[model samples]
Target chain A: MIKIETCLTPEILSLHQLEGKIAVVTDVLRATSCMVAGLNAGVNSVIPVIKVEEALEYQKKGFITAGERGGVKVEEFTIGNSPFEHMQEEYHGKDICMTTTNGTVAITEAKKTAKEVIIGALLNVGTVAEYLKEQNQDIVIICAGWKGNPSLEDTLFAGALIHRLQDQAELTDDASFMALAQYQQANGKVADVIQNYASHAKRLSGLKAKSDLSFCAQEDYCSILPILNGEAITIKKN
Target chain B: MIKIETCLTPEILSLHQLEGKIAVVTDVLRATSCMVAGLNAGVNSVIPVIKVEEALEYQKKGFITAGERGGVKVEEFTIGNSPFEHMQEEYHGKDICMTTTNGTVAITEAKKTAKEVIIGALLNVGTVAEYLKEQNQDIVIICAGWKGNPSLEDTLFAGALIHRLQDQAELTDDASFMALAQYQQANGKVADVIQNYASHAKRLSGLKAKSDLSFCAQEDYCSILPILNGEAITIKKN
Candidate 1:
């Protein structure tokens, strides 16, 4: 019997039973999307660091530093959190160290006990779901919400994943059902739904990151499955 | 400049900015509904206590003790958490001390800094919304989710309230908008939607508390507005 659950934010990660479960971490607005883009573009392993200083240290070791604090590029880092930034040919074949306000923190925390931690986002949700279905483990979808509050984009992405996997998985909690309902409510217009409704998308719009928002909202545009290998997130080459 | 926000659960209560705000607490499964029902039935006051011992002490001081843990009436208590129990004639004109698994704890926490705190549920949502509009203060709808996780019924109730209040109030965050969308999706079938979809409702059904679930799901069945007066929750006589 495989049960599926969702932890809406990182704050409630500790409450969910995670031992031996597969944790799919999503920060759809940027972090996980950026990871998917980077890994899909042929980057080497992407190290998810928690602090800006750690990313800077990785820069010193010849790895590209990429992160954001309040939706803007961190100072002295080579790349911003925008998925579009990782699509360049120069970024291909390079090692990238990434950090963000929510996504990396969630991944770091989920790595504590999850037997396997896989990065998920709108761009690669289908790939991630298929891989998880094959793994046949109890899955916990951890949404990296803004700060400590739930984010609509992450929840929507979780719903999209659940919609893909519901046939084989039991919806174990209300949050899962709620997310799937929201996803079904806005099916086929996910980008428009999220762009018009998500708080993070609105915030980025205020910062004039419309292109980044559109880039992140594209569904199934990438096929890379970034899985946590020890301390680094690298693409699973099938 | 009146902003409306929502705290989905007590776990994320700290992340929301609640100072100088009128906090509306909703525990629709039975706590807030029970409070609304008791106050409507003419109870002088309903004191919300966090611990069972506090309710027991209140019972010793000539107040009716009411609460539930694990959705059952606490041993020797005057009543369990069913709103139906509070609608009886004997509960009229009396002071009641209440505690519960999620609702009372959220109310106790909201009392710490909210300029004013009000209890809300599907039973009194219309009245609560009208009063909030009249107050013209920033509002935060705090949902008393099961333990630390977000519950479907509470979120749906929050959405119902948001649907009523969105015309005049600013939907301040992503959560507020998400909730309103949900309410709109389940517009006329709020009860059916919750009963069929809410995890708590299913749990209670498994416990054969379908009657309690139905009682809690009725919209606008009561007219009382439960507001925090100092430390006790009493009816607003407007």
Candidate 2:
């Protein structure tokens, strides 16, 4: 049986051996959701950088810079961390240099140890699941929690992916099982659950991103599978 | 409102500031459960040692050496990890020098940073909740997961404590919220939930300790509040 593991937060990612495994990194509040929407809207690729300064360097090289820190966009960046911003016609066919509070750091960390790194969010969960099932590789779902602490939305997203892959993969640890149980608890009212209970979602809502939360909570918004090939995240080739 | 935080595994305890906070340490599969039972059955105090060698040193000092490594009793020790053995009259009024795999390590670690450390298990969850509610301090429920990894039984036990204290305490982080949600999902069928899904319970079951699982799953089997006071876990004086 193919094995599936979960790193609840990037802090615990070191405890998991990522060699030869496909890592699915997610930040459901915004980072990954926007990445999916951006790629699906015809942005050529997303270059995830760890800092706003790195994104600025990419801006010098003619890439559209996008980032956020603590729910607000970095003033220096061209665009903020939002799926709607990424979906605009102005960004179509352009490569984005992106940074965010948690998602980019998690992606950078997972790419170092994982054989392949992919982004997973409600927007493209079904496609991510189908791709993993076809690849038949051992999997690790990395939740980009709020600064090394686990976040409800990211964990719930991990559970959603686990639930989809349960038939084809065996949960090898208690973390994966817990994620699945949490997902089962929050399946139908995911948006309501996050809006009402998730701390990060509340932070976003405070910044007037309630619509973003509702949009990110939707499943299969696009067929795009954002995979980190080297330093850039582009659509996975069929 | 009293704040309740959960460190899902002892590995994450360092991330939490435990000073001035009451720490509830639990290992539901056996260790903490048996500690509660042993104390209730009149074991004077439980000295949770990290190593069998230390327990042996305590044995030389006339304390009863009782511990298990991997669900089996040490050959040199007088007793194993079963709560039933701890409930026996033979061990009444004796001080137990104990060591287990996960629980003891967690207790030792928590004692270092927490203002007060108390043992928690299904066997004495009611008393734990009552004591914390009365103390009115910020609380951290530490789940002694399997060798630094999160365990189903322990996380569920944290959820149980969180559920009991939810009316009196505010959950401070996502881990506490997630634990409560999981507890809600497993409420009224906690034993069946662990029996069917907990990884540690499955390990114990493989070792013919199925009854121990049921015993550990029981609520308020004893009213004893075991608190660590300078190297020994003794009943808290009202």
lDDT of 2: 0.89
Best by lDDT: 2
Per-model RMSD to reference: 1.5, 1.8
Q: Runs in model 2 with CA error above 4 Å?
A: B70-72, B205-207
The C-alpha TM-scores of every prediction are 0.97, 0.95
Lowest summed lDDT over 10 consecutive residues: which window, candidate 2 chain A? A199-208
lDDT of 2 by residue, A131-215 (tens): 9989999999999988778888888888889988999888888889999999899857877888888887756654448888889
Give the top-scoring candidate (TM-score).
1
True contacts kept of each: 0.73, 0.55
Give one digit per residue, the lDDT tens place, for model 1 in A1-238.
Answer: 5589999999999899889999999999899998998888878878998999999999999999898997889989998988878767898889899999999999999999999999999999889989988988999999999988899999999899999998889888988988888888785898998888888877875444788788788889877889999989988878
Q: Name the weakest run of 10 consecutive residues (lDDT summed) in model 1 chain B.
A: B201-210
